[model samples]
Target: MDSNLYRLFGDRVRELRETRSVTQEELARRVQLSRASITNIEKGRQRVLLHQLIEIADALDAKPSELMPSPQSQSDPTMRRDVARVVEMLKSEKSRSDK
Candidate 1:
């Protein structure tokens, strides 16, 4: 995957984790990883395997697709907007679920 895509994926993970009020350490534990690994992953300094991606999504209570960045988001401004909109929607949904 493109580094930019990895960065986007990381950003999405951080957003979802924060929205769920989950700490990095907690997330790491859930994913059977170290806190430093979570930090590195969230920083886009570490690339995750496919299984790891699924594990992360499960840890966050999100779908794997939700954790992925749209391939076109890097090239298309409109797609980027769509991705941001979807992220915002997910945040809203999470908040509503908390209420």
Candidate 2:
């Protein structure tokens, strides 16, 4: 699979997850995946099966296609930054919860 495609998909997942205020751990639990697996999916380091994609989308109250980035949006730097921001926000939330 192409790295760029992976990135695009990952970003879309992260964005939707964040919009729904779902943490990685919660999503993982709902989807019956490990936290690491959720992290890998969001980081674009691991590929997801179609069934898993459907599960994730459902957990986030979204359609499967909503978890995908369009080719035009994939190349958009603003979209990447937005995803990065969501990651940072998640990290901050994690740290707060840990404390």
Candidate 3:
């Protein structure tokens, strides 16, 4: 997965976990993973495998797909253009600052 996509998925997982009032430690135990693993996933520092994804979704009482961002939303042309514009603007700012 793309880094941005991984981050988005991680954010979704965090949101669902919070909504279910589940702590990271508790979820870690349920999923048979370490709390650090959960933290890393929540922070987008780790990637989840298919089995882990299913375990997480099951623990949260959510569908696996619910842990993912909508493809359409992520692929929206307008959003892509906006992100590109922001990237260009940041680059321009950085170049000016470096000079």
Candidate 4:
């Protein structure tokens, strides 16, 4: 995945988390991840798994789509494809979780 995309996603996560007054440690606890993991995620130094992305979004009280980088923001075709793929996976995961 593109570093820029990761950064953008991380930035969104941090922004949303902060807006909700949630600390990294609290978010990690809610998501069942370590605090260090949350730190790495917010720093864009970690590649979040598909399930983890959904979990993080849920923990932050956000929709998965809200946590992702906008496909239109990417100039690279590969990045757009990557984002699209993740969006599809998020939809699938959400449906399953909702069941």
Model 1, 58-77: lDDT tens per residue?
78898767787665656655
- What are the clash counts of all predictions, listed in order? 0, 0, 0, 0
Q: Report residue 79 deviation for candidate 3 (angstroms).
A: 16
lDDT of model 2, residue 46: 84
lDDT of 2: 0.77
TM-score versus the correct structure, for each prediction: 0.71, 0.71, 0.72, 0.78
Model 1, runs deviating above 4 Å: 76-99
Could you tell me the lDDT of residue 4 within candidate 1? 79
lDDT of 3 by residue, 24-76 (tens): 99999999999999998988889987668767987998866677666565865
In model 2, the clashing pairs are: none
Question: Least accurate stretch of 10 residues (summed lDDT) in model 4?
Answer: 75-84
lDDT of 4 at 54: 77
The candidate maximizing lDDT is 4
Residue pairs that clash (backbone atoms under 3 angstroms), model 1: none
CA lDDT of 88 in candidate 4?
Answer: 69
- Deviation of model 2 at 36, angstroms: 0.9
List the global CA lDDT of all models: 0.79, 0.77, 0.78, 0.81
